[model samples]
Target: MNAAIHEFTAERLAGGDQSIGAYAGKVLLIVNTASNCGFTPQYEGLEALYQRYRERGLEVLGFPCNQFGSQEPGEADEIASFCQKNYGVSFPMFAKIEVNGDDTHPLYRYLKKAAPGLLGSESIKWNFTKFLVNRQGEVTARYASATSPEAIAGDIEKLL
Candidate 1:
């Protein structure tokens, strides 16, 4: 079997190492985010999903990325502050990481490989791209940047 997402580790925006394994057995909505993107407002919908389904095993993880248009050019503190103040985001947010190119974060590298995008492309096209993983750590689906969090609610419900 392929490696589970729980096998990866990333730094928390608040400044500490975090093992993805800590979220094992939880349904995950892993998203690449940016502060100034056109889709930035989706944070509200994401938070709504987290609030609505967290008790049912859903865990939304946000990873700030500046690889696209330099939209998330803030330091970890600024990024965390923006998310909380603007969208009241309480879901876990990770430190800035690349979602594409040479320095792509290892977690993202695994996600893209497991759920390649349109035309089987492994590279992420834009920020807010999401990967939904089931409790077993299997990547069940990949959602494009345009896919709203609300639209993924049913899928998450099924997993739960």
Candidate 2:
């Protein structure tokens, strides 16, 4: 586990501060999401994974991002409503954030550095890019936007 991740924090969509330390010792599927993107439907699969493994120490953390074609243009409440009404999402979701560029969230900065994408790229390619973290908080793998949530179940199971 990298000591840096635990030092970061994010604002919950519902309003409140969330510390990465809270998920220590838990396997995490951290994703950069966009509500209106073509990959938006992946929310259903993400929720399914959360429901299936949450009891086994899995925490699926969603972070909305509008960086990709202004896909997630909603406010915090709207994002919350969209997730709940459309996907029945019950996992923790954070406020909108930048996954790339200079203003990227501290947590994301650490994640991209820890698990660069294909060709060793540190920048996020698109929304729904997922980062798999081990129970100890070390990033084990990085999945691209085209990688369906179900496709990573086997890797997650290994972590669990």
Candidate 3:
């Protein structure tokens, strides 16, 4: 297994592939998001956290996923537009990627192994599942779909 998250890369929602290494030394809240899920509203809370702690080095990275209930069915453009218009999301958003099964993104694969879910399960259960990584690129914690972004502020504060 890779030693740190900086070893991975993902496609940006807008265009082009981005190296995760670019975010080295910055705390990351990586989340598997969806456009039609109940947790979709969490975008606002996530943006709030980003705005609050961004200058302090906190980055909320949103990765759209369709593995759960096919909740995210739009193309990259649609997803980007929806996030901006509905929630005014300004954080980095990535192209839709599979969170489970054979096609799971490498970044997610590392995250699951670094911080398994309840009962040591590595499979992501659903959309909006979050993984917190420290500035050193170490996977620190994993939050469930129901856990609100606001609830993670205290944890983020410590890392910052």
Candidate 4:
């Protein structure tokens, strides 16, 4: 497992700390999400993808972030409610976090470093930016916010 990623811990929306290390051997799709963003609807696609591949070892982790235009301004409970009510998001959703700036979560910092964006930029350009991690906890690819979750299914199948 990648030491950097495994070393981080995040609070689950359900009110508990979860060690990233616990997901060491699972393929992971880590996304920085926003409830009110235009790509918010991607939650449906993401949920579909997760449901389809979760039994095959895929884990879609969502981290709500309000850093983008105050789009995800709800508290953990509210965010959880919105996701369940609107998209039936059943995968693990984490407490709100900052995906960019000085307070960026350690996991996100490592992710950006592991998979820099176009032209080697490390900053997350928008919400829903995704980091695909292999079973060994290595960031294999970074998908832009505009890339639909379904569009990455084939690639995920290869990793599986």
Candidate 5:
């Protein structure tokens, strides 16, 4: 899975720099999140998943995205505050990024390539689109926005 996800050095929403490489060898749920979208509440379930299985090597990585209907329009600080105060999302979260088109973030670009959408489409349909990466850094599944976190508990449990 080398080069599947381009290296990135981005600030965590919590207040520090983090390298994507630090998460290697872990099962990762990479989600493009939005604080105002219909699926925004998934943060609660996501945090639930993280708190439940973090010791078992499950990592939930959130990348706040506003490209979908301006659902998330907040500064980095505000976004971070929202996540912490509202959902208790202790999981890592990055600054807002565009997940599709020519200016797509490097990490999203790599993920989309690794797991193409239906009919081979690379574009992300909406917020909350999730990419589940296995221990070997390969994307194992792509869950749409409507697929709630609790719905995938069984799959994550097996991975753990």
Candidate 6:
């Protein structure tokens, strides 16, 4: 399902399945999150980005993942509460998904293909790896976990 971001469907943490098409015509920041990863603190900067640019047309989509060292083992409710209570995360988060390997989610497969990481590697190295998508739903940039959310602010601002 490479390059399938335009056609992938995700089951929302809130309840049902929805198409990535729903986010068409908007800039999207997609991240793989883990509750216990060292970079988990990025959730705050992500939330800040969301709050600051959403009205101007930015949507940050967080996908909890346990594939990276079982860092995000919480159930749906627990995950939601952690994000809300700690980071005040108000953006949409989907069900936990595998970002790489044979079971990789369709959306992630699309992203990994569009904007590969360091040295053009398709595998996700760690938690908080991000993909930035433009209004046309084209994957534009990719940021590694160590690349903080604040660092990507300019790119997002450019898209807006």
Superposed model 3: Cα runs more than 4 Å off: 1-3
- Per-residue lDDT tens digits of candidate 4, residues 1-160? 3556888999999899999998888899999999999999999999999999999999999999999999999888899999999999999999999988999998898999999999999999999999899898888999999999999999899999
Model 5, stretches more than 4 Å misplaced? 1-3, 14-16
Preferred candidate (lDDT higher): 4 or 5: 4
lDDT values for all models:
0.94, 0.94, 0.94, 0.94, 0.87, 0.91
- Number of residue pairs clashing in candidate 1, backbone atoms closer than 3 angstroms, sequence gap of 3 or more or interchain: 0
User: Clashing pairs in model 1?
Assistant: none
lDDT of candidate 6?
A: 0.91
lDDT of 1 by residue, 1-160 (tens): 2346888999999989999999988999999999999999999999999999999999999999998999999999899889999999999999999988999999999999999999999999999999999999999999999999999999999999
Q: What's the count of clashing pairs in each model shown? A: 0, 0, 0, 0, 0, 0
Write down the lDDT that model 1 would get: 0.94
Worst 10 residues of 6 by lDDT: 1-10
Candidate 3 C-alpha lDDT tens digits along 1-160: 2346898889999989998999998999999999999999999999999999999999999999988999999999999999999999999999999888899898999899999999999999999999999988899999999999999999999999
Model 2, span 1-160: residue lDDT tens? 5466778899999989999999988999999998999999999999999999999999999999999999999999999999999999999999999989989999999999999988899999999999999987788999999999999999999999
Error in Å for residue 158 of model 5: 2.5
Candidate 1 TM-score, true structure as reference: 0.97
TM-score winner, 3 or 5: 3
State the weakest 10-residue window (summed lDDT) of model 1: 1-10
lDDT of 5 at 116: 91
Candidate 4 ranges with C-alpha deviation above 4 Å: none
- Which scores greater on lDDT, model 1 or model 2? 1
